[model samples]
Target: MLLAASTQRTIGLVILAIVVLGGIVYIYFNIRSARNEVGSEIELASNRKPYLSDEDLEGKKLDLALGSSLVLLTIVAITLPLYWLGEPGRHEGRDLDTWRISTNRGEEIYLEGAQCVNCHGPEGAGGVVNTAITSSSGEFVAQVNWKAPALNTLMSRHTEDEILHVLNYGRNGVMPAWGSGGGGPLTDQQLEEIIFYLRSVQISEDEIRSQVDSGVEAGAKALILETSDEAWAVEVRAAEAAQADAAMAVRLLGRADFDFECSDDASECLALDEANARLTAANEAAVEPLDAAVSTWFDQVSAAKATADALVIEADPSLADEGNEDDLRAAALEILSTLDAFEGQEAYLQWGEILFSNTAAAGTYSCARCHTYGWSFDGASDYVLEENGRDGPIPELADGYVTAGGFFGPNLTGGSTLSQFETAIGQSAFITRGQAIGQTYGRGGSGGNGQMPGFGALTEANPVGPGMGPGSGIVFEYPALLTDEQIDAIVAFERTL
Candidate 1:
């Protein structure tokens, strides 16, 4: 328990008062007794009288002085141990205070100084930033909102040194250099503080799993809509239009009325409430048709899996209810294979392609952000330009993407990936466990400078601390960003490209 500053000050003052009062009383009595002495400003007279004889001074008075010294010694002995016992706790609390202060300062830099929140969102829940794409010759492409990945689970995916490396040297042109080492403004210490702030905002493991699942589900739904019958697609589009309209109505009302949530029950507040209600209903309506389409797609996938049980790990039927993720993933991969997903066939390529360039998490879980040029700026979507009445802005690629013909990362088109790995499993493994800063990979694939990120669980040694040996450091297992089945699909798509 910590005392308030005022309370502590009051206590300190009371102790000071007691000590000063005691000293004043002692001096007053001593001075008052001095008047009775025969000497008055005459040092010779007092010196002439010899000190008290041994008989008078060396008995009770001497014993009392010795006893007082012994008592003080005892107090010191007791107090020193007590103070020593509390020292560790005191220092721990101080360290905690220092960490809190540093974290707050880092948060300030992230928001105001660095303005990372402009793209990464408040508290790192993820957001989008408007950026213009450019062709090789510097011709302007459409202005698009690029998805910035969430930092709440960053610690789960990256080690401290790895994150610091990125901070010092920003990711693929999207994220700019922040540290002075990369010719940016912030100092190394300040970047470390930003990382400290990131640590403070990390979400739970369950939250990470849910986020990954949601992304996959969204991509799966998009694939379903793309392949669905015309009636199904029309219904989905109509519901989406209605949802968008309701949301727009609410926004327009909110802009006019202002602060309806905290205001009194006025006319505008009632109108805002009605708009919100309509939005909620429309949102549900929109979800219904999309969910139906996705359900049908899942049913087809399930039927395929049932027929191809022997192709993969055919576990006991009873184990199906055990919720074993590995088993389920294995089954899913087998089903995809049965649908000819791994053979670079177009029939299954659409689903794999959707997974490869998934926009969920701003394509954080997908390969496109690193592998495809201008992917972040909606390079393929001309509607964004045409919708805004800006015409004739040529895309760098006449086609949507060069697939895995990489930009920030290496190109994987024209059977490069196939040549890199002898088998699909090896390629999948390499993609799942990304290259470390100086770790080697593949045939002639020298350890990259932290280029590709591991989408699956990755184990790396903790940076050796002072007095620690190479293999003695702690090992950290970064959480998987994508599931095995999802990763396999992306790998399959790359093979096709």
Candidate 2:
């Protein structure tokens, strides 16, 4: 009975399978007919090619599947290593904290612990890299010099904002902009972190002040030695005497006695000749004293210069050290401050003023041109006064304005007013040369844009401005223009503005 039941079950299963197979066959035939019609329509296209046979299609599909799998495997292999390498866990070399921070790309963009040590010397002291730098005095003085300014003093000398500006804009063409303007290779957060790091390492103000005092003392001693140099004094006196003698001789020669034969009257000529003879005698007498004075002065200047050179050599190493940078800067400030103590010492003011005024005059406009009393001409100002006498319009001063070119000039009323006498005689030399007189002074010509001409050279726009001679429209350029000394003096006075 069991064998008979098994046979019956098998027969039923076979019948069910047959029905399913028949349905599948019907559906496959109908799909094939539809595909044929579609294939024919597609083949009518101008660019259509012959369709692949079943065997060809199967081989192509096999190849595609293998290629796709290989590609996917390759991508996975590449990404896995990259992800692993970038992971913080894989970083093993430096100060973990610094490494984490630097690699973070979130807070700051700096090298991690060991990396920092590699470029920046230990203790965050700066190291030399091949970089072009500009001097604070606006001269292209040095390039890729191994002498790197220490970074430790940056905090004491500059505010955070100012520091950011310097980092972003760079200095003296030597320092490359390292912030946003420098392509923002790092995020803003990274810059701030670096700033924080710098702040953490800054020397105290007291230390800076002390160093400055020492520098000033050294400078003062040098100055005294210069002033007391008898030999230099003698040379200067001699030069002065010679110059005076030459002038007097020329004057005497100009008299009636020296008149040209073109003169119409012999009596006038005779009278002139007599006058000339008397003048010549007087000049000869004056020559001796003038020569003596000039000789003495030159000798004094030479001796003083030598003393100054020696003092500078001694002071330079001390001033340049990261430990003493504050003091050096302070010394410079102190020197500037002393200008007020020596009120009648026009020379000091003249020197300072030339640096200040030329920085502004080298550009198109200055802080004073717009802000008036609100801004100081020596690049110092506290308030931005309004056009209405209280609050001023927003200043459009860009980084370039402060260091290269500006639309306005600075005001110097906060300190001391420059006497016209000093301006006339002190800054004359600088004015005549048309050279930008300070580290921040701009180039003279309008930078490439024809609409604006440079202030240094003769331009159609500025025919009579500083450095330019009288306009061509004038009958004759002044035969003998103001001397450079006179121009420098004028610039000095302008600084007192």
Candidate 3:
């Protein structure tokens, strides 16, 4: 049994008390004995009155003293060994306590000191940052609400060291460098504390799969809903065109044009008047219909998301209530297995496409962020087209990407994955376990830099698991980033890409 700190302290106090009381009793007896025997007043203290001769004194007296010393030595030998035996456990407890304290401090900083919860969401559920995008030469582009990735599943894709590196140097210019190395406020230890907090928030394998499935389902339904409102689409287009015209008009006016209350025959005054009228008319026209369309669209999107969320819950209500993940995973997998096409190229392929392009969890469930150029800040974000003209840095893409023609990762266009894996199973496996630095994967796929993240339960080198909470200890489970069926769907989509 582990000795609690309280119990240890109590034991120490008892031992000290015993030592103090024993000293007190010994002193009391010594004082009483020091009164000098009544018969020794006239004698040479006790020395003259001693009855034991040299022979008797050398016999039992010496033996008794020697025996007492031996007994005390035996106690010392026994107690020393026993104390040593408990030392290791005490040290382990101390270590555990230290980590626990560090985790608590880190959490405090995340929630309060650093206030990371503002953009990253409570418990690292993921959220958004409202900011403006800009051009290379410092021109304003558009207002954007960028999605911040969830830290709940972060360890599965990266190790503590890697996560620390990100904290030190930041990523994408969106997350500021928090560590001193990157010239921000935090020290290396503070960054490490953040990692410790992140470890604790990571969701379990079942929860990870559930989150992934939820996002996938949401994406799938959203894509179908993408074209459901043709009338709304038309209204949206009109608003966009009006917005562009307004922007162009605003651009046409020069600073000098507004300097004077224009002369009646001035060309500059006429041009300014025309531009202002165009801008006013455009705003009035675009605002109403677009607002109505936006409202209707949000309602539909919410309903779609709700429908997707209910799928797994409806599949196994008993499992859901009991929180039996193993069974729930089976039920989820059962649902997933039936998603493949009963008709043409398979319905799973649609799910796969959506999953690949999913924007949920800051595209944690999506591949486009890494595989498609400009996907991060492009029309993937909510933009104010009115503020931006047709010349916005990232316009709404026609079909959203060359559908993974590839950017950061190797292009899988033209049946590239087919040649690399030769079978869907092999590709699925590769995506599941992911790549390690200096470790190769597939046929001739060079693993230089080893950035391919695992989609399944990762262990060993990866931070893995929801490493947080009381009594969970430090050994974190490798998080399963995606289910087997989900990986298969993505693989199926990749083969086509």
Candidate 4:
């Protein structure tokens, strides 16, 4: 109430004052009037002359006493059962009120108390969080913008209990543990309230699809707008075309024709060497302009993205009802979408590499944490060890560290992944559902717990009945670990390993 606008608060205060004064006056007048009426009646009775002799007066008194007793009996008979009949309804009403209060508190925690909006954004929409990359000892390293996933659609991925479990324990190093058991700030009840808030913000599947489709179209528009400059666009297209031609020229030049492995004195070997050198020089020359063009295009894209981000911020609303879809649409269409040379199969594998290593979620959870030994982070670091005082600097790995090597998890290198899964779909499925406790997965893999999180939607092993307890009417799906496209990319990358 204190945070309300000045005009609104003033109006509220005035109204409250009026109500309080009115109630006081009403009670005072009613009490005074009742007392006055009783006094007047008593005085009238005391002053009245005797209506009969002693015997007649006694008889009249007896009759009055009997009449008063009968009236009192009749009033009790009507009211007693009514009060008892209303008891159960009153209890149910109290329970409902309690739930409503808890839900409101949960919203408060999500918006203010827990500071979830810093990463998740308003109404549980995902957003980018800019923070400094720090070592385990709290030394500053570099700045990074981490991507937080949307919580509004969280139910489509995980059940309420699974979400509750995550709330209790947190994930990776990015998301701090929130429950008391994990030594965070919130209690179990408070966490539940946060979940309730999340429940209220969910959108329909049709709306989600529409938003995604609109974004794709908008992205294409932004791209065309950026590259619409005649001179720059023409230069970019020419450079790209030249690079493709150079690449094809290199491929067409057969290795057998340039076999320098033959005796250097041989005439054919000398001729082939000269030809190979000329082609290599031509390819290198073509690459230079291509690189410059790509750099310029990337800069433009970055600028466009920054503009879009600003628009998105303007559109963001704290409450679902206040959201401005027009602003969101404008922001989504700010950047240009372009065709990439590495589309189709090549793109999937490349994307997988990014997802495998990217610290998008709270700067912690990623595939490399378990699968790759010393890839880019200290795989040994865990919440349990950190709590037990095993604090140390997180050793940073050099770029292109030995990927797919075994660390905390199994080795995925040297065809090990392909051998286990047999097919890409198998690999994808394994990633989607993950391994349950003591459940066998893949070829000869066993004794696994639910350590490997699922990337797609998951079903609960056991769901509660509608009347299991309070709030049982509410249901939730297990949160997805990854999207289908993302999982496909990871699977492709793993196969390469």
Candidate 5:
């Protein structure tokens, strides 16, 4: 009965319980009646010998036992196969429940356990990450705001495994690794759940493209407003006139000369002070027209950007049914193929630079961060350190110090890349799969552990940490970080450098 309740064997147990209770009650009444019968028989046969056959009672008992065994065997034969047949459905239901629970747990970890939402935003839209800087001994140094990337479109940029690698090992000591391999805190199961949650938040490619185009259009409109307006020209001319009048006034009063000694005589000092006051007034007046022009331009640009963003939202293609998977793939491919139009153009090289330095998205997940000397960014200077293991007052780059020269990673300038890679394809491939631990890369470059992250696919497959449980040794396939055209553009830019 205890086993039945524990295992939830309800139907059979309920029947058995009823049968056992009935037998106990019947035996209680039967024993009481037998005791009365035996008492009467003993009184009647007080002084007489009884005659009876014991074989008849034994025959009746045997017959009853045989009948009960036949009934039990019949029931078992009918129920066993039915129980076996129901197992497949039960297994499927259990799996579904497990996945549902995992997804929920992942969302919780993203929001609360990991506090990823603080940097990535509530919807993973990205935001500023403000952290206090400290010395090795935990001295307060500085505070900075780092731009965190939008995870809503993360899948479009990187694969599951690539994202996992980042989660495990971290980046440049800014993003702390969360897996055990890098001495992080999260278990392997938690990492997998986070991936599941990310999959649910992905936006369509069409929407992404539309938003990008809107940004470009808004920038163009702002540029045109700055240069092409007649009102702006008038304001600039007025500002120039006022500024000249102020300069002339100062000059006539001799306030422009540094050695014009007026401290000894009271009258000379008073006159000098008056002239300085007039010059200050004129300078203040000169700024009004310029400030108005600048403010107007900013307002117009902001309004234009808002309108463009709204239009993009309204024109999103994902709202409508786009046919089969093949059709969607073809449409996406066509849009991606247009990136090649910038090939061999000057703009291509400039685009590569933007990709290398831009920290608005994905933080500073760019090549320059690893390649350039002290090239860490926090919404301020791109290069934070003047030299290794020291805080800075950075020197001027008067000698045109190579920006992409070696720092944490190797130097890409000085024709070294050209020597390593003979063709564009070879360079692109090397950029795709960065240096893994114990693995040699382009030309004679030695392996430097898993320091370099691959932009194409993950090179390290087996799980790195001990926290990974059963079936953790399998490889995680990730999506490429940069598109083929983007990689090609970077290759072109690096070759020129």
Candidate 6:
């Protein structure tokens, strides 16, 4: 049986070979058949016109094949690269690009629009919002509650690391944590860039100190703004004349030579009597014009204040008729015109009061004790012994009088305020100044210079500074830290002042 099966397998293999040979023969015959059909078509065409040679036909076929190959290769080459290049990972989002642009240190970040000019100022030098920060008692203080800190002097005092920390972590409730630690919106690198920009700011402490020290002289000049430049020149000439008159009075008064008088009754001496009368006349004549000028200036200030008050009341619906908002606006314009008439009178009066006052109060100290009050190009004032016997030159008064004892109160007479003198300067300014001074001077737990006293819980909306706000006798003995609205109101009022 095995031998019979081997024989059958050999027969099957021969048959399979024969079938393969037959299929090849059949395909060869079909190719020849197609070539014959093409030849027939060409023969018919040749019968009608000039026939193509075999060489030319072979050349055309070769060219067609080569062109098709090249076209196929080109399509594959072009598409392969394009398919790979169009992958998702290659592109980034527009927001990411925008963020990169915004975070660049050299670029200017406009918070909102051109109106940023109105507050942040040209280079962010203590804008309308931040200028209100004051130092008192060695701590950083703010007159208003929930106010942003100034960026101007921050570079001078704060380290880059500290600034970055603040930017990331924010301050109090008002300043949000802008760093990852506080779930901030900005990335760590963005925060660092901001810090770098802030650190680059350069502010002159010397210039600020000089300005603070010159408060008195600035006040004196403020008083004479109502007089025209020509009038001022005339006044100057009058002042010179007064000086001569004063000199003449001194010479004629016989008081200059009181020691030479031999009369038992000096009053009975005719020469002395005549001299006294002449001296009195000259003194009176020299002072008359100056007195008149001062009176007129004050009158102008009073009138302007009345006009401004009226306008303010009209603009406020609570104070005026709500139905006449437009009318109130027109009225405000009229008031502004009246205010313009007064011109520099308000400043002059304020400055005069600051210059001549025995005691000054603002924020936390006396201005007279720390600045000069008289006129001199070189910046010094002569000592005027007050009627009460207080004596010191302007430079002497400015030395360390306010900060000497470490807790000297500031003068607020000529400073900005919110409500009345007591509310604005006494309460608000003092609290803020005390906080800043405390931090700067190193008097608080934070451990700073300790040059001034600390406001403690009083620095915050709730009690956070020492002393619990300013003392009693003026406004509230210890008022709460000011609100943002109150601060704004105070600032608005201060700008007017």
Best by TM-score: 1
Q: Supply candidate 1's per-residue lDDT for 309.
A: 43
Q: Model 4, which residues run further than 4 Å from truth? A: 1-95, 135-139, 210-416, 419-423, 435-440, 443-455, 458-474, 477-497
**lDDT agreement with native, every candidate:** 0.66, 0.39, 0.65, 0.56, 0.57, 0.39
Pairs with backbone N, CA or C atoms under 3 Å apart (clashes), candidate 3: 200-468, 341-346, 341-347
Model 3 weakest lDDT span, ten residues long:
461-470
Residue-level lDDT of model 2, residues 201-233, one tens digit each, is 554445434443343333333333334345444
Candidates 1 and 2, the one with greater TM-score:
1
Indicate which candidate wins on lDDT: 1
For model 2, the stretches where C-alpha displacement exceeds 4 angstroms are 1-150, 225-227, 230-497
Per-model TM against the reference = 0.68, 0.27, 0.60, 0.45, 0.49, 0.25
lDDT head-to-head 1 vs 2, winner = 1
Per-structure clash totals for the candidates:
0, 89, 3, 12, 2, 54
Task: Write model 6 residue lDDT over 394-429, tens digit each, in one string.
Answer: 333344233112112222234322222332223324
| Per-residue lDDT of model 5, residues 368-469, tens digit only | 657764344331242233212235423332233456786568888877887887655677777777665567877787966556666664433443322233
Tens-digit lDDT track of model 1 for 1-497: 13343455465556556655775797699768764335434344654866676568768998899789867865765565455545555755775786787789899999999999999999998888877666566776556677787787676666667787888888756788898988989998788778768877877667767776676578777666555666656555556555555544554565555563434445544555555565556556657787876676666544544444434444456435556655655554534533353332343445567767767656666677778876766766644544334555344555666777788788988767767876555677887777777888777787767667777775656433321227545464557777766677666667656
Best-to-worst order by TM-score is: 1, 3, 5, 4, 2, 6
Q: How close is candidate 4 to the true structure, as a TM-score?
A: 0.45
